[model samples]
Target chain A: MENVILRDVGLRDGLQLVKAIVPTEHKIEWCRRVVAAGVPEVEITSLVPAKIAPQFADAEEVVAATLSIPGYLPSALIPNARGAERGFALGIPKLNYVLSASEEHNLANIRRSTQASIDDFGRIVELRNETAPKTCLAAGIATAFGCTIQGEVPEARVYEIAAELCGLGADEIIVADTVGYANPAQVKRILTGVMKEIGDRPLLLHLHDTRGLGLANMAAALEVGVRAFDASIGGLGGCPFAPGASGNINLEDAAFLAEATGFATGIDIEALVALRQTVETWLPGERFAGQVAQSGLPKTFAPIHRQAA
Target chain B: MENVILRDVGLRDGLQLVKAIVPTEHKIEWCRRVVAAGVPEVEITSLVPAKIAPQFADAEEVVAATLSIPGYLPSALIPNARGAERGFALGIPKLNYVLSASEEHNLANIRRSTQASIDDFGRIVELRNETAPKTCLAAGIATAFGCTIQGEVPEARVYEIAAELCGLGADEIIVADTVGYANPAQVKRILTGVMKEIGDRPLLLHLHDTRGLGLANMAAALEVGVRAFDASIGGLGGCPFAPGASGNINLEDAAFLAEATGFATGIDIEALVALRQTVETWLPGERFAGQVAQSGLPKTFAPIHRQAA
Candidate 1:
């Protein structure tokens, strides 16, 4: 069993994309069900301004609720230093902070320049060190492959930023296809460069299925030795900053791909498939995407062995 | 530029699934448009019994029409030795012959036992040798990954058949995920074995998007160095013999993935994207699938350079 980590971001990334703000209670149930489905980690919410994105208004409550699910790690996307402080205060073991490789997208997404975002990441790292030394801070390099506004992002620029993030004490470096513009060649090339520059640091990938290359990119990342990936249950996501971007790679599908390809994701495909029904029922007409949901698992599919949580 | 071949199977595989018998003229137009869109090869139609599949009643006409398209090779599916005689008699350049790796699927599909299919394949090769030595014969092993009926196709089984096919002088040895049950790992593993066994034979991949792993499987195949592939326009196909089988991989999406992943497919993605509209209109209410059609080409896409064809 190859060791691969599939971190579910449905509660955070998926919910944010929905127009109808799901109640906090439903979010908790979604969290519980996904954790029970064998996902080891879940990005429950983003600590952004609730005023700007009302869908994630109950970020704190959602994180708190997910923490109660024992044996599963809970994470939150912290947009800036303020959000990092909030997440750290809430005792999140891991906090994902994002910066865009494209200057225009960085400005458009977080209302800051590229350097400003880097500075914020440094501050967030310092805050984590001071307040919660045990917290793992992952710096996600968004739009690392291509940007909707800026188009092709240079691979050199991504490596330079990844090196900086590594030097600034970021525990993990994540290459994000913010607009889903990455192809496998780009993924392999970028991850090869980013990994080379940030030697020995854990590298994760965040992908969107905007152009339907999400899982392909994930497979490329795996080929290049990336073991961690961010996926959303039912393929629910859309970046408000990056227009036309679809959902993150579907969690169940990602888990299925990983496990089927001989990587042990510790996920129960049948459980996830069963839970997907509940999710579809919960979010009617929400356009949940994934094939295993429609085609069901193959008879040859063997679910990962659970260690009895 | 990486040389990857995308063989369009929209005419043969896609239409065979359609209940309506597409007019011969429309089929001719589709063939012309797809060839103009820059596919190097097109599987024109299946030389099967019209009583069995009425949609391909115009098989001979379509093949004759497409042979006029300059700079692209034309192929047709030959189910048995008689079909091979028909194809070779029509002066087709290449003939694709399929044999199922799953014993159950082979029996169900062509109504022949595994040994009987192999014996038939030998006869087809003899016919090709006698009639048109210039015509290339490709042996496609369906259910190479998994089968709907048998499930979990052993890699050993695929390699054994591929080795036998190679011994029989197959110009190309192709692995087809007949039921789309392949994951990237399964693809890599099986292809690695099959390629090793069929050393130096032109190995191609035929994938279905049943589990949404079409592009992912393509990337995996690419990783393992498979250069030729079978694709259908608008992701159309439905295996009548296999109960849960879906369409072949989308041609435009396959081209997009191949080109995007740094392989020079020689496909004008813009043209293919545009032609997809005509296909949609031609088959109104048909469930055409592919992400590139919905999201358009990305800003980073660079169409492969065509050599004045």
Candidate 2:
């Protein structure tokens, strides 16, 4: 409970941009290997319409298969009440809901106004309460740090949004570096203010490795007491600026840093690396980023695993 | 002087790994931009014979052209006495001499024995004393942390080699993560011991981002009074592991960090980014690595360029 809970997002964020959609069977197996290697939670897919996110058409199937494992929570990204309702029917315990802070970004990204998104969030909470009472709703503020379209999201605006989301009965507030435009100072300043305004809710950080500050930002967050992190196995996410130059922060490498810094992540980095090799070879031509995965853990590294049990 | 002088190694280290050799004129212009951006020093080329490093056949011409720029110390990597003599005679004031620490790497990489390398270093020092008395020699111990051929180089061995180079009259000692196998803990452990043995002589840490630990290791070194670093312009150095894994710490980004942390780095990042555009057009095939180069600095980050004189 004192340590961080890392959520592997490769299956969800990593496959979003790829030309080849990984088969459901292979993805299920990939999930199994990473979980076996000691990853406690995973974001398996976004609940987008199959027409748009063909890679995640099998999101329901993955959730059903992954739920059978003990000590593992399979999370899915949902945009509206409908996706939240669909995810609840499929029985995912956690729903990672997202909204954009900028009015310009919200309309461009989700085809809804920021005010309209707030309205939709209120209904999604209502749907959650009626459909599945126990399902935890972790609301993510995507591009809360900045936006490519509008640029430079003010900290006050982010704080205002987080307060509104909390008022909407959201249980968890996660700040995301959606476009990878955040520096560590920006992350610290925003997270500091947001946590102060939101007050004691589960504050999670979802950072992108855009501009290569993913890990550095995580380190800043770690110093300030934010423990839950969102990362992809082998850093598989792509850059909206380009295709995949904006890789997701690699989960195995993140685990290595957490453990290295005397923070317990309950992850075996070598096992994660082994799991990543299968993922890499299984899906050729998919861009993979992470230093520890490329060069195995240093011979001197010692991990403390199984203590969490 | 307190800020680390990170020499941009792309022209030599980055270009060496690529199959195509960049033209001499473009390289000279690149050097001009580097000097113009207030990069006080640079590793322009490795002084290996034209047969070995034909890509740097223009080393003489490059350094000679760089000498025309005032207040910039252009350095060369001298493998043997002949390379050292060549660099010294060209009037490039500073020379960085290197040899692999691991016996296997020395044999495989340079085709010389470790003990024989020590003997050659002694001769090179003698030659420098007679031929060019004012030359600054920085000794780099390659594979000092680990080796690709023989994994897990002992910390004791790294300390011993770093000590021997200083004893053999080498001006400065460089502890390099040549194989990209160093962790921050390892960097701290080895460098602390090396600093204790080789007192007050500046130790330059040449790190690779292969495992994304390049910046992490730099942070660790900063805690231990290390102020001199070796970095490339675009994180352009190739991963000895292969092509496409371009893994050098980008100098412009590193300068941003130094200035961000309130340390004094005599570099203008805006000018450096402008210089980096020169490479993007020249080497379209090259995979350049740098975060600040892609994402412009936050409007708030105003770096200290120089004293108000």
Candidate 3:
């Protein structure tokens, strides 16, 4: 059975837009619970100024707590070279950098132009090499599908940005439908184009379920050979730029898709669903979305490895 | 842009499970509104006895009203030869017959064996030939993917049933995920196999959104040249046998998917959304599901025909 990597970004992307500042201990518990469910990787937090996103004020503390977990592969989001430096100084093994393909969304989201963010990415790569040589630098192009503000993001622009990121020595390339405006056909086309530019570098998809096409897009990505994806527990993480939209694809549902389609995710769906219940109790007023938790896994469900055996 | 036929089954399948008996006039209004939204065909009602499904007690009145609408192709579901005779007597242009691929589900749903249903279908075909030769006979195999009552229905069983129906003179074949257990890979495999048995006959997929894989399965079906699908307005419909599951795939979402993926659906999405609002007012207690109604269409959304123009 083929295996795919599902990275839970609940701590970083999921909590960023949240109003309530979860305690460092609770965030650590979240990391611990998701890891116990056999998630291969986790994005613990973003190394940004406390004032920008008060919810992630304890980023360093969260990172320290996650590093204490044995055999856990933890990553952090880095918006610029400064954030990269923070991650490097903390000895984080993976750092993800994101820039939007849509100009309006990039400026609105990070207060910089797309080209400026691209240039910053180059500097971050250099910083990673000089300071944390063992660190993996993953460059993610946000709004690779389309943008709520810009309306239409050209396929060529996404390919061009990906090629530039690759030239800047990125260890991996990630394409994100930050606003969830992607369809399966568009997902296949853009990922196919991005794959051509980035040869054999590991690729991941970060998709949102804004229009209920997230899993469908994931299926298309799988068909095109993308083996890694970013999902959030209970479908957490809404884009502040796209209003009236749901969050990222549900982690349990993504694992279910992987297994049901004959791929091994190594993640226990029942455990994730139980964790989601705990998460809902802790978060209080936040809106969560996922079907597997409500409907339960199908009776015939068996992991790909089990089916193979 | 290639064209696909979207048949709205809200009035028939969608209302069948509802305890509330929607007024006959309202059902007529639904037929008129959906046709105005450019839906080419609609399954307006089932020809079963009112004692069986009281929600469809006014089936004849609904069909009569729908047939009065200009250029609208209306179809009805018939469970037995008696139902088919009623449809023929009414001069209905199309009739749909459903049998389960799972023997257990067949007995539980229609209170008969799979072989008996097939035999009844054969008799219905002979009756249609004698009384209404121009009427199109669409034979649907429910639980074709997997079953809640009987898990893991074999692929060969589905192919065999489709072949038998074709030999029995079925005008079209429909593969249904009645319990919403289909994955995209299985959808592709089963539909590919069924297509080989029923060559050149029109095929439609009736899918449910129970597990959130409806559109993904639809995408896979489209990849394999399936152009017709069954959807419900506001995603109304549920399997009594599949507890805790959501309804059928949303009509607006399905049309949005077809248009977004470069297929021409000729559906006015905004109009369908408006009708969904009206539907909600009419059926206050029923739970409805759809994303396009909540998020609104993407800013860049243009139907395939308009994109080509």
TM-score list, all predictions: 0.95, 0.83, 0.96
Ranking by lDDT: 3, 1, 2
Predicted candidate 2 versus true structure: per-residue lDDT over B1-309, tens digit per residue: 256676788888878776678898888888888878888777888798888778988888888777787767788889889898898889878888877777887887768888788888889889989999899888888877777776667778777877888888888888888877666666777889999988988778888776676776776676567887888888888634332234677787778766655556688888889888888788888777777787666444666655432
lDDT of 2 at B52: 78
Angstrom error of the Cα, residue B114, model 1: value is: 1.4
Q: Write the per-residue lDDT of candidate 3 for residues A1-309, one digit (tens) a residue.
A: 788889999998898677678888889999999999889899999998888888878888898888878756899998888899999999999999988999999998899999999999888887777878999999999989888999999999999999999999999999999988999999999999999999999999999988878899999999999999999998899777666656889898899989999999889899999999998988899978877887887777887652231
Ranking by DockQ: 1, 3, 2
Question: Lowest summed-lDDT stretch of 10 residues in model 2 chain B?
Answer: B238-247
TM-score of chain A by itself in each prediction: 0.96, 0.95, 0.97
Error of 1 at B211 (Å): 2.0
For model 3 the local lDDT of residue B37 reads: 94
B1-309 per-residue lDDT for model 3 (tens digits): 788889999998899777678999999999999999989899999998989788888888888778989856899999899999999999899999999999999998889999999999999999888989999999999999888878889999999999999999999999999988889999999999999999999999999988888889999999999999999999999876666657888999999999999999879999999999999998888878878898888888887663332
- Is candidate 2 or 3 superior in lDDT? 3
The 10 consecutive residues of candidate 3 chain A with the worst lDDT sum are: A300-309
Question: Model 3: how large is the Cα RMSD against the reference?
Answer: 2.2
- State which candidate has the highest TM-score: 3
lDDT of 1 by residue, A1-309 (tens): 568889988888888778678888888988888888778888989899999899888888888778878878888998988898898889899999999999999989888899899988888888788889999999999999989998988888899999999989999898899888899888888899998988898888999998888898898888889999999889999898888888989887898888877788888877887887887877888978888878888888886663443
